[model samples]
Target: MKKPSKCQSPGDSSISAKENDAQSNRSRDSKVAPKSEGLATGLDETEWKSRLTTPEIVLKEIRTLEGVSYYHGMVARDLVESKLTRCGDYLIRATDNRIMEFEFILSFFNKKRIHSHLTIKCDVEAGKWALGLLSVNQFSSVVDLTNFYKTNPIGAGFFLKRAISKGKYMIAHDRIKYSPKDDLLGTGNFSDVFRGKIELENQMVNVALKTTKLLDDTMDPTKNVKANKIKKEMIQEAEVMSQLRHANVTSFFGIAVDRLPILLIIEFCNGGNLQGHLIKFGDRIGTNERFLYLHDASAGLNYIHAMSITHRDIAARNCLISVNGFVKLSDFGMGLKVRRNESAEKVAEDDDGKENKEPKLPVRWMSPELVDTPDAFSKMSDMWSLGILAYEIFTNATKPFFNLDDTDVMQTVKSGKHPPLPLSMGPDLIRLLKDVLVAAPTQRTTADKFYNELHVLCTQKGALSLNGLTINQIRGISRKRVEHVTYRKLSYAIRMVTREIGVMHHRRCWLMLFGGERSEVSSRTGSF
Candidate 1:
């Protein structure tokens, strides 16, 4: 019988071809292979075994592959080793049966290092042989490259070392790149936003990295819980943001969690936020400019709602502005997916009588149904918040419910009461606000409707060019002014409550000091 050929094996042929090509290329170039320098070099089996037994020799072997290719190779090797070791020859057979089904993911260290797209295929009989040994499912399933890398760093490291020996390994865009240093740009409840630079193929790009602390029982009790919650929230937000691609929304780069404190890289908006701009030029900005800002912000919110995502927190703080005065929605921390016919009752009941309640729903901007009933909020609720945001933009950063308590605000909303706006505001804007702030969720205007109407209004008002504001400008202005107003109102309310408590305390003290005399005086007054 003819000897079996390696080409008859599914992945084996490809593997052999790859190895042979490397060897042939190296020989033609007269280049020395790094592996040849090890104990295997010019040594018998017994000598090599002795050298391999030494820890120092093993360490030297590891140091040989210290680049990106080394890491990728290590990952691939680990994946192969793990599957083969666990399932044995069955896996080898499965690969042989369906070699073409497998995908080869080449992750580059840098974008420029990649010369061309990868092409992978397997031999038919080899694939069939592997499949006969293993189940079809095992051989046909796609592999997760990221998970493979996570488990097999050593094997990946080795492969990468060899692959990059002759040429530079290119980086892929999807791969996570490291920044030199963490520069703190903004701080939130659980995360500190950093301004970082990532090196791409030929140039470096600026990105905002939101780094959050990890939660562990070893940490302070209060902080541990808060950190965990924040981490979950950030993950959800990142997931939503990454899937979304829009000019009016902030772009989410990939997230990194390999290191403690997960990092969320995002496109850096150059223009300061809307709140910042308002502070600097509140007086200088014309009425048309303010109207344009509102129109742009509403447009963004409309896009989000159309995508079936609700921006529960639609305050000015979340609207980022670009240097060119374009507004993009940012900070999806409080966003929730609102599918049709979903019951909010379940979510509310799940949290019923819990120690930590849902982050106090944004009371000031929330619609009546959102506050009063366990109704899964609709797009209209977002529209209500948008109305509040529009009012803020137009009124030089003034907040709605500037003086109302949470209870009172809820009551007013339930009672269909809205904050007064200046008479100078046009009827079209007023009509749009009313439609959005309707007490019934069903009565609320749809985002598309709102955008269309607003666009028409802007055109009629000769303010069509307002869409040019950048994301940074919007965020800066919205953040500074809205946060200031919220905190300021909260402080004032606390002071008022404190004063009332003091007066009540004084009356009680007097009554306690002269209880008998006061009782006698009350009786005499009643007799007179």
Candidate 2:
């Protein structure tokens, strides 16, 4: 599958390693109780070792002990007794030979020095719990409380507070529906994207479903393991996104995690990506529209930066245009959060910082410092990419360093050269590009500074009014107009201007006006 490029560009090794170390320390400090409770004395390990371990053992134990319910509804008394005994919670399971039911009640100390309780239930019919039930509390269904307790033993109280508010970020596989003929939208290396319809708020709406590539059984075991690892990373990325709510960033609906080929449902963009939009409607796109797109992108980048997140892949290709012309940043495959206190300069100097095995980065958009000093990556790197994106927007998405190969491009960038700018770009924008393309991390503009300048530019042009339909939405409308006003006007003009110019000359002119290779336009629209 064709996945949008994130260009690896792993964070500087020192920062990442330090983050890993810090996480490891937290994990060590927060000791969780083991998830597997010991058998009640008599049952040996062999007897408990069935094809299914957890549910079977839990079923047998609950059946033997009888239900742990009280005859009286003496809430205060139970709280006092539970506190005295340090038995703050009760988990119960029931079965009627054919169907299984689980109920878990957790009690915690509230701020008023009183006990509070939360109850979660799960039911499974036949053998397909994954498809048969959608639990009211998704976390309870998705996370094993026993395992959670064990993992966060020291931070049990803290974890509980956060978990209560967090939704379960999983979607059962059966709920996802897509067909190549009807729903396929695009593909990427890591996943395939499809336009899907799902029930939300008692109505069906179009959603973009992205599914990861699964390992083939016949593939080498090592490759399979790597693929699984990649899938896990994508899931983790989705989990982070699920918590974010922003206008500039793409909205993540949820994810399907219970089976192979995991799926992520995101808000659909009818206008496709920024790069495609620019290519399709470049000639008709006015300066106002282009600035509007830039403004939207800047706003999204600034928001993410404020949240301490770095969208490592900042490019026109990764930016999506909604039908209303609003731009939303998408593709979080290589996205990561850095601690607010972490200095970009310090991260640039960490040990094991020069490893060539880091993920592949789009060389043309990379900052010189990032290329020269491996593991020197920072948000400044993304800022540099934003500079390239600016260049892309002004030039109709023409490739950066179009004449150079990857190796040469890196060397040239390291030598402090940037792509040649079109002479027509205004001084303000050229200056902005210079600030973003500076070789020193400290010299580059911060997201806030860039955003401020964009606002200033808009203010100067009296284009400050952002009606909120994104540039992409405007482009979509313009595309529809092509067959009506735009096509007629262009066709009439072409016929008039080229009346004496040869047929071959007319075709060449048409190709130039449309912004694509002759062969491509010919194949799609047929020879003029």
Candidate 3:
């Protein structure tokens, strides 16, 4: 399989004639030099032959055929565009329904001119009909084209079928199912979580969904607030998640909004939250396990930050562990869209109104600015929270700010005081903690820089002794907590129901005594 040469000029017939001879080995190859028209006068026979053999030309011809579709044409276009001019290979499907393999050897005569010689072998037909060019650029480059086809075979197939059926390309049909089971995941005011099957598409598999919720409850209607807020948050989160198609981040399935409870169905993580895992397994989780969770969390956060959104709440609780050991950042409730022009004055004003009646902020993990003023939130603040989370994970669920009351913590934060790293903590971690937990927001490290530094610390040669935790261990801890909390609420409801029954009986007796005598007297007077 000799490579094809690049197209230089019409007069440059050496490579073209050579390519024709090579292509003729399998089937008879003919070179036709039609006179150049108008602006194409400078174009010679070789240039014209190159244009005819070009992938673009082949793709265009394929589109005109009855079976070839627009999407396949696009895929073909991408495959060709990405090819190097000199070293390219392609699989051509001829107009007469035969496959021919060819390679192009590219060379540049001048900056403006190039030449190519195509070596081809016809697998089926003997003579040339209308040649449909599918050029291969290099050996093993087929993998690149294969990957593209694998990702978009359905799309291409749909385009082909659509063009054939309708005589023109139309919108492809979306057959994604949206059902009640798909609507199980939801985000709350304080937490973002989801409950759904892990494998909704094919088999029955259990999975839990995770996300952050940031919508103000004061704005949503009371009766339908939670559902409405969850729905809206899910929609927005899905939109954002859809844009972020990364392996480290959670994978998004099709969403179901037509039902009463709108669901942003996602692949469930059977392993619970990191916070619960540490509390349950504590000393059992090795250093490497710890680093794994941290690494995955950092990767996910880095991706989020890259998309210009800060995961404001980066805690163990928000880091979800899957049964298969995959870690994903779940809650997006507290996440904020990074703004370019966030003024300090505007932040101050927003905080001023909420001074008297502010929601109880998580003091221990909160950044100094948040404790000092409610509106003092930024990307730096999120980094501070991440630092606190890392500290919690490292310590195996020790109290975030132990031995300090909320007021004292607030006061200390206001005065620019921060908790010191434990003596046992490694230098890399200690540095990370100090850098993120700096009192001044301006001085705090950015998420991007933090992630890069963390990656180095984790991957570096024995910087810190740590390993990653499995997703199941993390989930086991979190799930137990959720179950226990649920049981407590259910028990409370049962007790309340029993007490209410007795009270209702007493009230009924009292009503009968007060009204019974009056009713009897009225009946006797009617007779008189």
Over 4 Å off, model 2: 1-166, 180-182, 213-219, 223-228, 334-360, 372-376, 464-528
The lDDT of each candidate is 0.44, 0.50, 0.42
Write candidate 2's Cα lDDT for 41-149 as tens digits: 1112332232112344333333332222311111122322243222233222111110111222344444344444433232322211111111221222313543354
Residues 1-528 of candidate 1 have per-residue lDDT tens digits of 222122222332222111000001111223333342222112223333433322332223223322223222212222333222221111111111122122232232322232221222222333311121112211211122222323344222411211221112211223333332335555432234556555544456666665542332223433332333444455556655645544456666555432223456666666645665565666566666777677667766755654457776676766766433456677664234221122333221111233322223455666777665524566777788788887777666765777776567767877877678655458878888888877777888887778778777877888654333333244332221111122212323443444556744433332333222111112332210
Error of 3 at 499 (Å): 65
- TM-score winner: 2
Give the candidate number with the greatest lDDT.
2
Please tell me which model should have the higher TM-score, number 1 or number 3: 1
Q: For candidate 2, what is the total of clashing residue pairs?
A: 18
Q: List ranges where model 1 is wrong by over 4 Å.
A: 1-182, 188-191, 212-233, 334-361, 372-375, 466-528
Clashes of each: 62, 18, 49
Model 3, C-alpha of 123: deviation from truth (Å): 67
Candidate 1, position 439, lDDT: 74
Candidate 3 C-alpha lDDT tens digits along 345-417: 2121121222322223455666777754555666787788777777777888676657676667667766766
TM-score of 3: 0.46
Q: What TM-score does candidate 2 get on C-alpha atoms?
A: 0.55
State candidate 1's TM-score: 0.50
